[model samples]
Target: MEKIILIGDSGHAKVIEDCIRSQGGSVIAKLDDRYQERFYEEHLIKGPIALIDDLLIDDVKIVISIGSNHIRKSIVERLNIADEKYATIIHNRAIVCNSVKVDYGTVIMPGVIVNADASIGCHSIINSNSVIEHDCVVENFTHISPGAILTGNVKVGQGSHVGAGATVIPGIDIGSWTTIGAGSSVISNIESNVTAVGIPAKVIKREGL
Candidate 1:
């Protein structure tokens, strides 16, 4: 079994730990800037984020268990680890089709369904029970939150967040760095760096405006 080092120690971390275990991998340690002691019922707390370099070994894989796309990207960049050293975890309970392609460092949580021809980019999160339909393209660092649904041919850009339970209709394009509010229904295209909310999703806030 491969030994993994996980970053972060919160609820999201716990879920990622379970996903790792389900895949026949063991979490040797959890590193977080906050807690100094053992993180809950899991492995020993391996001090702060600074300890990552010290703990890294030749065979040990690393994964960022944080939920925030920005923070996850930041941690990966800060560590400067090779792409091969990053672990891509998919819970055993996830239903990913044979044609789906998931890149490195991505996490497919329990109950997630990724259909045929869908491509999920590096370090993205397909959270619990989320559905990525056929031909969907989820770019790097994006988060498809728990229970979110992306219909066929939908495109979710880099660093975007589709909030929990949000639904994007077929062929909809969600731009980079955008936020789709929880439970919203997106029927049209959303531009970059904006927050879209409500039924048929409308831009409520744009970056710097």
Candidate 2:
């Protein structure tokens, strides 16, 4: 069993810890800004989130439990976290097909259903209760928020954020750096660096340009 350190200590962090345990690994410690005092208390300890550079051990690996794409990327950049050493944390209850390809540094939360031939890119976040159908391609640095649903053959571009409870129809191509609002329904193709909102998911702005 490898000694692992999770990067967050929130409720999501706890869930990832449980998943790590179920994967036949041991969580040696956790680092977060929320629980400073509890981190020093024996087994379930905490530490600084930004101190990963100072705290990373030779045999230990780091797992990002944060659901936000921006926050996760920022922390990675600030701490200079290694992509090769980053761990993918998947919940035990997640129904991920064997044919699915999940890249490095990605996390599939509880109740997520990733069907066959789906490709989840590097450093992406597939939050809780999401369903990704077959042949769906989610690009790098993207965040599929909780309860989102992507139909078959849907392609979400790099650094995009599909908000919570949102639904993307089949064969839709969502461009890079786009943000789909919560509870929205994407019925058409969305372009890069834009924010899409409402039921039909209209483009509001060219985000991150």
Candidate 3:
């Protein structure tokens, strides 16, 4: 079992912790900016993010475990450790095919179905019950939220968020830093740095560069 150090403590982290436990790993420490330096639980330590290097050691891997794609990517940049020290967590219940490519720091939550030749990139999150169909390419730091579905040959760019219950049809390309609103049906390509909502997914806002 891996001795893990988790960074972040939101509700998302709770699920990530469960995913870790399901993989036979133990979360020995949790670091977040909100907590004071103390033992929050028996055999567990809780402290600020500044305590990261002090707590990290050999045989202990780290997980950002945060829900925000931008913040997760920011922290990933801040972490001085080698990529090999980052942990990729997949819930035991996820049905990932043999041809799927899962990179470091990614998390595949319970009930996720990643079909053949799907490529999940580094630091990405495939949240609970999400279905990533064949040849889907999810880039780094992306989050496919709960109940989201990406059909065959879909390409999701880096730092994107497919909101809960969203559906991107086959061959759709979602650009980087984009957000597809919850329950939206994306039938066409969504460009970068925009928020799209409604059925057929129209861009409602373009984020500043």
Candidate 4:
């Protein structure tokens, strides 16, 4: 089994850890400040983030357990981590098309259907049964919640989230850090950092729209 280091101790980190273990990867260490000597005793792990290079015992891959795209991108950039070596974490049951581009650190859950030419950004989550049509673009750190559907040529921005069962029309552009509510229908463009809801997705938070 390959050794993997989880890079956080938050609740999301715990979930990622469980996911990793479920995939049959060994958790060599956790790279969080919150866990100190106590973590060592509890998990029998020896290293942390500060000692990342030191803990390379051959055939080890690092996974950023951060939920936010900004945080994940920032850490990866700061560490100068190579995209070539970074692991892309996909559940065994995900169905990705041959022509799709899935970046590193992205998590594709079960029942996801990414059609031809769809681009799933790094560290993004395509949740269960989400349907991404051909030529759709999902930027880094974005989450396509369960049962969401994006028509062809749709662009979902970085750090944005499309809630469960939402449907985005074809050729629409959704900006970064935005949130589309559950069961909403997006007929128009959604700007950055706004929270939109309802059919046709009106801007609820104007400051970021």
TM-score of each model, paired residue for residue: 0.95, 0.86, 0.97, 0.84
lDDT of each model, Cα atoms only? 0.91, 0.85, 0.93, 0.81
Which residue pairs in model 4 clash with each other? none
Query: For model 4, what is the error of residue 112's alpha carbon versus the real structure, in angstroms, after optimal superposition?
Result: 1.6
Show how many residue pairs clash in every candidate, following the order shown. 0, 3, 0, 0
**Model 2 reaches what TM-score against the true structure?**
0.86
Return the candidate ranking by lDDT, descending: 3, 1, 2, 4
> How would you order the candidates by TM-score, starting with the best?
3, 1, 2, 4
Candidate maximizing lDDT: 3
- Which pairs clash in model 2? 39-45, 39-46, 193-207
Question: Per-residue lDDT tens digits of candidate 2, residues 1-209?
Answer: 76677887678777777777777788877888765444465665577775666667787788877766778778778777567778887878899999999998787878899999999998888888999999999998899999999999999998899999999999999999889999999999999889999999998877454
Q: Give the per-residue lDDT of model 1 (tens digit) for 30-80.
A: 888886543444336466777777778789988888889999989888889
* After superposition, candidate 4 runs with Cα above 4 Å error: 14-24, 41-48, 207-209
Cα lDDT tens digits, model 4, 78-149, are 778666656676666677888999998877777788899999888787877899999999998898888999
TM-score quality measure for candidate 1: 0.95
lDDT of 4 at 77: 79
lDDT of 1: 0.91
